[model samples]
Target: MAPSFGIMTAPSQVDYADVLRVWREADTVPEIEHAWLFDHLMPIFGDPAGPTYEGWTLLSALAAHTRRLRLGVMVTSNRFRPPALLAKIATTVDIVSGGRLDFGIGVGSRPSHPLARREYDAHGLPFHDAAYAVAGLAEACTLIRRLWTEDEPFDFHGTQHRLTGAFGSPKPVQRPHPPILIGGRSSATLRVAAEHADIWNIPGGDIDDVTRRSALLDRYCKDIGRDPANLTRSIHLPVSYDRPGDTRAAIREAIDAGFRHLVLGLPAPYPADVARWTADELIGPSA
Candidate 1:
């Protein structure tokens, strides 16, 4: 199958108008199937003082503005918000987008990434160890799904989270909740994705490494009695305006590696007509 293509506009170092403009244009282009924003409370690249918008918040605004594109945060940090609250926020976005929402989530940024780590300190959010974060993410997926699908209010107690009388009202526009896309390359995360995610996404760069990770994910899925084929393979490839050929080559490699869902990451200070340019220069040629 031809891989589905999407664009990811990181909500940092760019004005809302800039992101909106690209999304609106992408909406009209049939070639662009979805759009995304990164989940970051602060800038992860360029200047640390640069403006950065909240992912879900900006996603809601973009969801309301665009008519056709399926939109979401590429992967929300599970640590940033309570599972129940995140479920509600995701439900709201799904409703706002008229069911055109893909719920992407992950265990959050690794503490080793200095730029991403500072956001936790600035926000007064606790930074747990890898084990705790991965375990919490697993628990979160279970709790959020129940909230989205259960008919009655229920309580949940887990290793990382505790909820009393938790229930999602005005459930998401997508029946049985939006498609869950879990992103990460760790084995632990791949285990979580095997059990919970409808799609699994990873950053693109080293095709060999990503291919190995995909094979690992297949093993994880099989171990859990789930068919690995049921989970869609997605990859995020950075777009290069000066080197469109490089981007196309990466796309082709990802597709050949069994990734059928492609998200092209556009750097900030976006060029005018970027979405169309993506379709014409990158996605079109790759296709």
Candidate 2:
């Protein structure tokens, strides 16, 4: 199958108008099949005091402004919100977008990054060890899916979370719920993705590393008796406005490595008509 392309605007250090403008423009461009936002409570890049909009809130607003592009947070941090609440929030966005939601989630950010770790303390959210985070992620995935698909209220008892009389009313617009796209390159995450994710995404930089991770995902899928091909491979590549050729090269390499779903990450302080520039300068030549 031919590859599909999309754009991601990290909601940091940029105003709402800027993001809305890009999404509105990308909505008119058929070559751009989807749009995304990253989930981070504080600025991971740029000045520490810079403005950063909460991801799902911004996504819901953007979803209302655009008509066509499939939209989602690149990968929501499972630690930021309870699984049941997230299920409802995702459902609302899907409804607002008229069913054009791609549900992306992960085990949250690793504590190793100082910038990322500070958010947990700043926001009073717990910072668990890697094993705990991955296990919680797996349980969250199972619970969230049930919340999206089950017809009646149900109770969930898991090591990480528990709920009683839980149910999602007005379930997501997408039948069987929106496609769950889990992002991460960790083996534990790959195992969860193999079981729960319809689409799997990882950041692009080292093509060989991502290719190896993809192979491991395939093995995990087979171990569980699931066909590896059933899960779509997705990658996020940063777009360099100064060097469109370099961006195109990365896109081509990712495609060569079997990533059919590509998300081109647009840096902040976007140029005028950036979406058009992306289509003309990067995507057009690459195709």
Candidate 3:
């Protein structure tokens, strides 16, 4: 598959509907298997006041608009929704998208606005601790997967969640469950991905940095005696092509280094620069 490439439409200051249209057009681009959209309440990188779209709402719209192209939240915050509710949401999205849903979830990064009990600074809540957060995420994943895959009534008891005699109806279209993707580069994150994630999405970093982090994940998977092949390695890269043929070389370079997915963040202004960048750097003949 030559390392499938996709676009991560960072809704930072861009028009959501317009980006959705571009993504829908990308379905005809032949090389794109998935079109990833980030789930964040605020801009983590750019100016804080910039416009940012809510992730799931955007994805739900994308599900309605896109066909053939897989749709996903690059990584959603497990802290934002109850595990049982999230399970149903993923299942619903999968059914609606005809099995094209990929659920990428993570512990919330930075304290969420109108913050609740799960964030770093909320009173009476534990601060950001890797061990505790990983445990919580593992519990959530276990519960969510059981809710989706188990036939008989299921009960889950863990450090963070407990469920009894509850079941989710209309199981996801994907057998067993929709693919679970965990995003992060920390050791705990790697361990979680090795244990529970079908895909690991790392932040954009240099090849050597990515390789090193990936080796850590591979080692963790090996220690657990889980075949690394079962885990997919994906990277989110910020790419721009000012001239013809620039992005292709970078694409080839990433593929050579074992990146299975490359998500290029198109610059803002939905109809102008983003469209041109998508055509030239993402889906163009040179790309």
Candidate 4:
């Protein structure tokens, strides 16, 4: 199957409401199966002082405004929110969007900032340890899935998270639950995604790296007696420019390499412009 392509709508210093207008416009255009937004409290790239929009709020807005586009956080940090709460939020958003939600989560790589840096100190957690982060994220995913799918009350006791007597109301519109997409580029993340994720997204890995990691993931899936094909493979491209010519060649190459989805990162301040431009020049025309 030809891989599907989508846009990443990372908010800049621009007003939140305005971005929604652009997102609605972009959503109306064909060839965009999904629209992803970054989940961060502060700007990770571009100007350090540049404005950063929160991911979940933007996703909620997208859910309310758009009809066809699958809206989700490109990858939200599991460290920030309690797993149970995240599950409930995902369900609520799924309901709001009439079943168009993808919960893309990751062990965040960005360094902590001052305003929100206290979260680490509060939890007595090490901010930069990738191993610890991956473990915690895995535990969180386990808890979330249980909360979403189990009929009776369940208990989740883990070193990083513990939940008891939690019941989520009005299960997500998607059967079972909204698809879970695990994001990151590491052995731990690959193993976690192989074990649990419905989809796997890698932000900026090369094709060789992606192929190698995907093979590992398939091995893990097969070992567990699960069909590896059930797991969707997605690529998150960085700083893509939709120049003249076959601008979609990159997307096609990723598709040929076995990816099912392509999430393009939009440059700041003009994210909508870039997204719309890409759609008009590349996605719409090609489709």
The prediction achieving the highest lDDT against the true structure is: 2
lDDT of 1 by residue, 181-281 (tens): 99999999999999999999999988999999999999999998999999999999999999999999999899889999999999978998888899999
Whole-model lDDT values for every prediction = 0.93, 0.94, 0.76, 0.78
Task: Spell out the clash pairs found in candidate 2.
Answer: none
Number of the candidate with higher TM-score, 1 or 3: 1
List where candidate 2 sits over 4 angstroms from the true fold.
none
Q: What lDDT does model 2 reach?
A: 0.94
Inter-residue clash pairs, candidate 4: none
Each model's total of backbone clashes: 0, 0, 0, 0
lDDT per residue as tens, model 2, 171-255 = 9999988999999999989999999999999999889999999999999999999999999999999999999889999999999
Report RMSD for candidate 1: 0.7
Q: On residues 26-133, what C-alpha lDDT tens digit does candidate 3 reach at each position?
A: 776666778888766666665656677878777877888878888899888776677898899888889889999989998756444442333333223344555767
The better-scoring model by TM-score among 2 and 4 is 2
C-alpha root-mean-square deviation, candidate 4: 3.1
- Candidate 3, residue 265: Cα displacement in angstroms equals 1.6
lDDT of 3: 0.76
Pitting candidate 1 against candidate 2, the one with the higher lDDT is 2
Q: Across residues 36-132, which tens digit of lDDT does each residue of candidate 4 receive? A: 8877666555565767776887788779988998878978888768788889889989999999999999987545444445435545645757778
Query: Which should have the higher lDDT, number 1 or number 4?
Result: 1
